[model samples]
Target: MNLRMKIATGAIALVSAGLMTFLGTWEGNGQNVVYADNLARGLPTVCKGVTKHTSPVPVVVGEYWSDARCAEVEKLVVQKGQLTLADCLTNQQISQNTFDALSSHAHNVGTANTCASRAVGLINAGRIADGCRALAWAPDGKPVWAYVTDAQGRKVFVPGLYNRRRAEAEMCLK
Candidate 1:
């Protein structure tokens, strides 16, 4: 190659390498399936209608899902969660772990709720530690009251939500 063309090629290579390094440094790897698994662990499949904690809407009987079906739902949930994070976060760059945690949180609480939550606000404000803490308290800030009134007038906490929040918080901190 000519001297000028060689220099230009070398410059392009350097730029590409730098860009790849920069992207690698930021832990934004797409781990949607992992996040969905975390969510599924938190929200187990049930064969009957049940009320999800802190959510006014009840999970209808027909909505109960498991196995592949559950995975499909979780996939959709993670997608929504990602969109919610994109919409809510303005300046903060998030890692794969952070995305997984937040996606799971959004799946449980909902995209709108997660976007409007204190966690998102804190994250946007550059208070990542505080944001993780807020994510831990995602159950409407009530970790102790693991149960809410179901459609049958029964007060019972949805299984695994508290533990799920804790896991999400830990993931965020990582």
Candidate 2:
């Protein structure tokens, strides 16, 4: 092949490789299906419809957790047939624009971390709609919260689950 053709071919290969890596583990479906199944129960699934709406989830950050014995509910969220935390939070009741911004923020914080500040910022900036929204609350019984970890995994929980709200969002932040 000529130099131009070789360069074009190399570019295509590089793009393909990058795309595959970005997709993470998948079977043409960006899903770590095996990984999901192999984990213990309550490890959180990426699937949305299957997520229990009223399910009580364990909240933990660093080490403190709500009901130290309970586990976090695990659910899978898929975007474009590829499962991702970004897809789950976005696709679930939340709007598309919000989803995009949240997705970007999640990426910036590493999908798993998906910092609570992003959600708080959205609400504070008035980008998010007014109403009840799900967020991990501090264990002390306040409104603000950051990251929630459990014996199973770490994730944000819907609001109603708390009696008066777990703890304010501010308690968990560093």
Candidate 3:
């Protein structure tokens, strides 16, 4: 197959896998749950029988999980994350990869912000490239601020968030 065909095939497979994972149909291991970058980065979580936190802090507490608990939390988060995207993106037709990537970002940032974001505006206007580029910015269409405190307790830019935005932008392009 040609390179284009190969890429198309791979994207399809990825989308299918992502959908299954999001829907809780695909059972992932504890490692998968623990290693999800967004999860570890202090994104909002939905643990069963546990009240969800409104404003989550950006730190991982490793001592707070059993294998069963981790899996349950992962599934709940994934399902809720997809729902957030669906709610915000009502009536819009987007590719699976775009949906997955944007849902990941929206999951971290919040659905309200994602719904009102410049990226969504651009997307709704059918300016796909511009919309993808907008993913690198904050939801308000400005540069994302650095909130991570440094050694001296001063806020500093987080390279990880920058990298994550870049990855999301790349995925939107795909």
Candidate 4:
């Protein structure tokens, strides 16, 4: 097979796997009394719950959004600004200038031990970006930017997910 064909085959496999796992998780988690919707999206890591805060936490991070966290970001954007105040936080430093930098920096990695605390730590320690790229990414295993409609069907303009999803692909059309 040619290089392009090989790469295309690999991507189809990844999307299939991700979609299957996502579907199964939705089926498993959806039956609960809480989740408002099923068929929700999954990120690179579907970490277990975050450990309790131990203090001196520079910032909290996680691999995937709690179904609730997704909803909260959605609510704030609709009520307040394009991006929520919480969206501005990053391990690098919390400053007005940092917001734009955040999206350029984030990339997701799937972890069995997923959790918000770990996610934040990865973001802070710079592991999230480094580790994701370090993984055995095929030409296709990059993350996709989702419209991320929330419970109210509003789009949360999360810059990090947007950029990472785009950058992970061919990187640039040019």
TM-score of each: 0.53, 0.22, 0.59, 0.22
lDDT of 2: 0.31
Query: Number of clashes in model 3?
Result: 0
Q: Which 10 successive residues of model 3 have the least lDDT summed?
A: 48-57
- lDDT to native, each model: 0.50, 0.31, 0.54, 0.30
10 residues in a row with least lDDT, candidate 2: 165-174
Off by over 4 Å in 1: 1-73, 138-147, 151-159
Superior candidate under TM-score, 1 versus 2: 1
lDDT of 4 by residue, 1-174 (tens): 422233245421212233223323322332212222222332111221111121111113333455565334323322222122133334433222122122122212222122232333444465545423322232366433334566687876555444543443212111
User: Who is ahead in TM-score, 1 or 3?
Assistant: 3
Query: What residue runs in model 2 are displaced by over 4 Å at the alpha carbon?
Result: 1-82, 86-91, 115-174
Better of 3 and 4 by TM-score: 3
Give the worst 10-residue stretch by lDDT in candidate 4.
48-57
Model 4 stretches with alpha carbons more than 4 Å out: 1-90, 94-98, 101-121, 131-140, 147-164, 167-174
